[model samples]
Target: MVPASTSDPVPAPSPRPQQEDRDRSSRRRQRSAVILSAACWVSVVAAVVVFLGSGKPAQVTDVAGAITAAGIVTGLVGTDLLLLMLVLAARIPWVDRTFGPDVTMNLHRRLGKPAVYLILGHGALLTVGYSLRDGLSLWHQTLSIYSGGDMLLALLGSCLLVLVVVTSLVAVRRALAYEAWHAIHLVSYAAILVALPHQFSAGRVLAETSPQGVYWICLHIFAFGSIAWFRVAAPLFATDAHQLRVARVETLGPDVFSIHLSGRDLSRLHVRGGQYAIWRFWSRGTWWHAHPISFSAVPTDTGIRVTVRASGAGTRRLAGLRPGTRVSFAGPYGVFTAATRTAPRLAIVAGGIGITPVRALLEDRDLGPGETTVILRATDRSHAFLWDEVRALVRAQGGTVIEMLGGRAAGAPSWMSAAAAHGQATIHSLLPDLHASDLFVCGPAAWTRLVVHDARAAGLPDGRIHVENFTG
Candidate 1:
């Protein structure tokens, strides 16, 4: 591992064939990720098969009976989707490694509204279907559902689920404090609990011997068991084994600082460069919030370092933390490292504090001369933190570095400055071997997306482009 503040030169890289082999391993992981995601959908499809093959529906004696029967099918499908959502959000390690934390989280986000919509449709259709059958008004039918066994609790659960989804919406989530929002979101467990009784009581399909019943029971056990083992148990065990504590803290630039931590057998954590951890400091004003931070330096036998910029109250409190404050982490998550590389050559484009992980990536291993290239982006010269140290490291490896300063070129959609974009400063310009090199980008969401667009326009394949955005 490199020192916290250093201008020392780097050594040469390892062999090319080794990197190629690592790339192949990454492709295998990608395939596994696809297979796992497909399995989730397959499970949903199987539930539908059980419903149809079991002879569970009415004989269509009348129009009202048919409507009510369709309602049952919708309810079954909705419940299955909700279960899948829980499994996806369980933070299973293999799933996180295969798809990346960001990719999995994005997938988890996409499933939210669809699952909730299905559930809402299930409730409304059932109300209408039952009303027609009983010769009751729609309002009376809803009242009827509430009056039945476990029906009131199930209704409450549905309402709570709706509130959880509403609070998770982008605009509303932004307005609430993270802690406040998390508290409300935890109510989802109660929602699931309250809704379970009705499924057993109201089922013709979910009897003990039914395939549907057996599958759902196993699914619920697996989902909650995964959360227990990976999310809760594993973190607690790692925290105790590491016994991590702050050893030193140093200010790097305005609002930015590096935290040096000491712990037992640190490297065994298996954290890679360009990956991040959710850090919780055991201290007043800091312990409640877990900040996602990247390692600024590689982990050593006894210590590690993470760079943080004070962008929020949680982070601002981090800057004031004292030595010996205990720490716990929940990651080493992300696939932005060289293990995901697909080419012999490497190119890095870093924006502002995004340089933290990029710096670690550079130091992760030795780089052969001419094997790497870098383009450092900043609003201006003063905002270019850690440039001196980076330049020294790149010079040691015979790599190239381009410092692009200022906003978008001519206020256009380019990531380079106006003068640079007009000249030889596009993605192709900086990385002459653009299509052949693995490009790693880290930055604010919008800026990173623009750079990725430029890379795609230059004909870089999806597999060769790696990106990390600070936003969740």
Candidate 2:
């Protein structure tokens, strides 16, 4: 029942419905984005105001003094950027919904280097400035600063911060285990705590009685509170109430396995299809590696399943887990579900094991017959992990399915097979209603981008296309 045929004349659209519903949702997202961006920038501006207005802006009478004044400025701004970085990583649901987790993580990485550099420059410039004012050598000034209040702990914190950042760089991270990297990154919390004493005790602008000081203190509280509540307290509460556990594990295909989890009060979970959760398995060897997997089917009152391809070492450990292995989860996150649908028609493209979310969506969404089409891609027939399920659903809904096999053409900048490329098959070729349909593409990021490129080339509006890369 692999109804693998879509080579036919296209059907015409029936009378259209109003675009108000889609437009309204899109507008709300736009407004939310604007508000979040403006708030972040506003914090930066307020930090500058507090610094300049705290006292008569220090007049630099000499080069050494000028360097010192600049150092102060950098210190204020660097701390501001660091605070922003903390907020980005706090996993706040509102922030995640507004800008997306991927976009927020990208911003976190982008701000890291510059924030650290500014802090470094602040340290260097102040060392020179203070040394000149005191008629002491650089080494003597450094020793003197370390001897005075909280500087030693700050120095140690800075070293740990540097280590965290260096290990997080893309090249260095590839060599480290996810668990190891995460352990190292946790040191960032200690670094931030230790670095705080010197800022409050040493810096002139953040003196305890000052307005700037109050604002800065509030910023720290808000940042720490967001992380503690969302990443810690909320998960703890949810796990206690739900009592989630592994019910069974089934082999789905070659090297693929599905973990069926059962829990209580799942309706309170507020989950949707096509969304994923971060699953932490409480097994002897696998307790530390939290796996991100999407639902293969929409959850029931007490049951859910997450399908995984056991390629990585961490994933391979899943098979040995005994029934009733306790499970803790963080979310039913991601915006690639029905909420992203902007049209009445649906066209989905999924590759390899990327079919997980798409399969869930197919089952969850209310698509009329002939209102959807799907293109499933795999390296071969066996790799098409859920093709039968897809075939059954698409056929039941009167939607067409096209199964693409084999690798891309030699030296070709395409995501399709050699045969399809030769036949001039494009997104529009497989999906004749491409312009009117909401297109969902899930795969490796690079291959997903190529599909998006094809859609864009055919002049499809960006809003009509949705992309999901399984980044958890």
Candidate 3:
């Protein structure tokens, strides 16, 4: 185990207030998750109820009738899932505050394919069912259906949904540029709109004058309204009001640099240390791409800082940004902060460039002396960009900073340096009081998972372990 560096180890103040705050935050997050999840399931169940109550189920007499009934049910549930997916992607304040943007996006991704599959099932089942009922072939039935009514629009919507889901697959997504992928994703809105006409006009259960029709209309309004306000209007308003611009760019290492931004009343953004913002640098070279980057330092009255590693074409262009380049941003988002702390003492594990947020968290004025133990990891000294800054901050707080330097081991417990792996170092060995401390880990996704696994194996409760991966 690496030795801790502390000038003077003193006992911390009573954490009664902090504990109470954590308790409140935990309750709030839990309540939000429960309410949102229940609402989604209720919507799905309500869709099924509307279908059954409309006398659609009783009309089934043959195999063809059964297939048609199944198609109707699938359509209702699939549309509901689509609306829910839209809401999750809306980035509403309550949702972001509770689960953070990463969790929200992850949920959004998980729902996409299933929603598309159900929609496709609805289409295929209806085609076969109708064709069989009319004693016609599937191809002839499809041609007849698409030749009239809103079926063509429905077909177009289904195709768009398929395209969106296909592009989202891991291999396909990795092959496309972010900008191209995002543009394709935005096509989902058009898909939803085009698919709506057939649901209200062609479908019996949700006909214009039906009660279920009103409910479906309200659902659309709610989903689109949230996206309109939070994802679009709010960010636009914040950009205009703040009038942020690049003050300077400072190189911290080979391909890592910090962008210092000056703005009007920056403190009003209410950005916590470990939270991030979706930023668009309005420069000729970089305005097309938006970045989700963490704050490397706490905001002052008129300024804030975000550090970025030039890992891709978009970020590499950021390194060339000149002073006075305008910036527009979406948020001060995330839950990986001091506010999420549940224990009196803190154990922070940060690797590579993930140290940016950890650096900012350490600078929090609320941090008490001897209340933190930080472990910073890197492949080599050159990769440890903010080590000195972290060390200084921890030292001033009367806390300890343990540096884990060297190439990672080629085998099991691969998150640690080869030397530490050889010496059999583990999470419990590095942070002896880990059970009593909130373990905040941020790093590469795979490495972060390993650290979290070790923390859990050491019997630390799941709630006490917070993670933010630097996969971006």
lDDT of every model, 2 decimals = 0.80, 0.82, 0.87
The predicted structure with the larger lDDT, 2 or 3, is 3
Model 3 per-residue lDDT tens digits across residues 1-472: 4434445455764666767887887787789889977887899999898777766699899999999889988988999999999999998878888777878889988989889999999999999999989999999998998886787899999999999999999999999998999999999989998987787667743465566777788888999999999999999999999999999999988899999999998889888889899999999979999999999999998999999988898999999999999999999888899887778889999999999999998887466767788989888888888788888998887887888888877756568888887787777887877878999999889989999988988899988999999874
TM-score for each model: 0.91, 0.93, 0.95
Clash count of each predicted structure: 3, 0, 0
Error of 1 at 22 (Å): 3.7
What is candidate 2's CA lDDT for residue 228?
88
Best by TM-score: 3
- Which lDDT tens digits does candidate 1 get at residues 1-472? 1011122223435566767687688779879977998897898788777777666564658777677667777777777777777777777777877878888878776776777777777788788888888889998888888886788888888898899899999899999998899889878768877888887786544446777778778877887787777777888899899999999889887788899999999889887888888889999999888888999878998999999888878888888889999999877787888778767788899988888899888888677777788888888876687787777777787887777777665656776766676665657756777776889999888889999999998889988899998652
Clashing residue pairs in candidate 3, if any? Answer: none
Q: What's the C-alpha lDDT at position 249 in model 1?
A: 86
- Output the lDDT of residue 219, model 1: 75
Off by over 4 Å in 1: 1-15, 58-60, 204-207, 407-410, 422-424
lDDT score for residue 310 of model 3: 88
Candidate 2 lDDT score at position 425: 83
Model 1, residue 214: distance off in Å is 1.1
- The best candidate by lDDT is 3
Better of 2 and 3 by TM-score: 3
When sorted by lDDT, best at the front, the candidate numbers are: 3, 2, 1
